[model samples]
Target: MSEISILKDFQKRQMLFMELYKKAFPAVARYISRKGGNYEEAKDIFQDALVIYYEKLISKSFSPINNEKAYILGIAKHLWIRKLGSNVINDTIESAESEAVFAEEHLRTDKLIYLLETAGKKCMDILRAFYYEKASITEIAQQFGYSGTRSATVQKYKCIEKIRETVKEKSLAYEDFIE
Candidate 1:
């Protein structure tokens, strides 16, 4: 694709991502909380999933073979499972399912993190602030010295798209790690 077309496509995907994020976050938070995870854990899992999604998109390697919602939710589920597994929780059927999902999710999450770490300090800073710190666009703009919140928002979206592309290229899935 031409530069303009690629940029436009990316922008479109970013808008979709933000919308999906807004919609899925609450359900994800509730799921985690119900499973004995705290608010902080829910937030971390959600953010990690978004980071993975962003990495997949930015690398020009992601193709939407399935519903975006499922893809993102799968990532979140996997991350939550990993978090639970690392804790000394009792292993029940539900917990086992979570563990299974998490084992699958970890491989992708690990790769996504590796790619994000390689994306340099700026991408990491923006992702950390927006995803982990839960900072607003205005706050990030001020902190990053952007011209305005709009600029910061745009930059954040672009960074997320990059992450999504990176994840997609690998075609990692929950089934991959499940035996």
Candidate 2:
């Protein structure tokens, strides 16, 4: 395939994953939460499920699943069980109990995320495009209206630096909270 065609295929897959994330992650996360798993675990399992789903979809002998949402959810559950066996009931229950101890810390993390979302959304968008969507510099430039690849690269670095500064500022408030 040509470079342009490869890029298009990647973008198409990114869109597919985005749609799947929107459709499937909330329910998966809720189930994880109810099972005493944290948000990070939920994210990990969901991402793994997407990888599996995407690979199957792209395989030469692909057999389409009937319901993608349910398919992804089932994959996520399987992965979660594999990662932490179903016998981890006590661990998960204890995790839920320990969450209350970290409630204050979670609030601080939430505040930092809020700042990132509100004050640095464009930067976050660029970073997300680069990291999460695996978008090429050229693609990111075109999408974000950057003049060129170099411009996009510069903007990406600047955004990373800006986010670092913002995170440092936020971290200062939690110096005591840290151990």
Candidate 3:
């Protein structure tokens, strides 16, 4: 491409990015805000999401997306979730105003674990191995004598689902009992 054409293309992309920022950022900001993230974090995630969107746009497999705003918002949401998974809990702990909340959270976590135990030792073991031990599916399969990784993966999902159900069932009962 000629230098003038290249400059024009860059200008076009710059305008497109600016437009995307104006059109898509509010929804992303609101989502991150509702999830307890600050404005700065929302901006950071949105910027990162824009970078990802641009990369995807330029890739060989790129397909024209009909809703750029939704695409960018979805990317921002995933990035925020990943950020939460990595550091939000530690941040929350460090910034907590009172130890009471922390202690209560600890107690609730312990109770959940105890409830999981009551559900079944095998399910608890499966969860502990995968999450706490960070065991790979193959390792879990080998250790548990599953037929294959797929079976181990299915079992792990079932264990997680069971935990969710246990928590949902117990949360109301536990809160009532505590009060």
Candidate 4:
């Protein structure tokens, strides 16, 4: 299907979920409340369950094996248990947050991004399309009005080189950035 159709389907599903949310949330709240959990915690867990259910329903491999309400409730049960520190992989909420540990390269990447944005806009756009957005050479060529992929590839390399040079120059000018 086309992008518009996919988006429309998603919106339809979102609206459907609003109805499901009204139906499902009360049971989730009652379950949580019985366990001494607050309303906010119940809402958080139910939303995550809804997202999981939505992803599964939209996946290409999906089959109608179980009713949507029951499936979502099952997922919510697992999520609630995981929240309560019963699951090994998700013993605590902090454990999940800790998994996304920052890397040192991110700092250098930030500096490179700053230098690229300040240095040139067209080059920045092209490089972001190629690297950050992962656009194909043909797509990039078409977007930027290149003759073909070869020309786009060459321009991509030149942009990379320009950004690298700017990064080197900036690092040198600002001694704090060099090391």
Output the number of the TM-score-best candidate: 2
Cα lDDT for residue 47, model 3? 82
Q: Give the TM-scores of the predictions, in the order they appear.
A: 0.44, 0.54, 0.44, 0.43
Could you tell me which residue pairs clash in candidate 4? none
Is candidate 2 or 3 superior in TM-score? Answer: 2
Return the number of clashes found in candidate 2: 0
Candidate 1 — worst ten consecutive residues by lDDT sum? 170-179
C-alpha local distance difference test of each model: 0.64, 0.66, 0.66, 0.61
Off by over 4 Å in 3: 1-8, 86-179
User: Which 10 successive residues of model 3 have the least lDDT summed?
Assistant: 91-100
Model 2 segments more than 4 A misplaced: 1-8, 87-121, 134-179
Relative to the true structure, candidate 4 reaches a TM of 0.43
Give me the displacement of residue 72 in model 4, in angstroms: 1.2
Which ranking of candidates, highest lDDT first? 2, 3, 1, 4
Per-residue CA lDDT of model 3 for 1-179, tens digit only, reads: 53234324744654566567656666666667667887678778988988798778776687877667777777777788788775333333222223323323333444544767765878876775664345799989998999999999999898878767876876645333121
> If candidate 2 were superposed on the true structure by all CA atoms, what would the RMSD be?
8.7
lDDT of 1 by residue, 93-112 (tens): 45434544443444344453
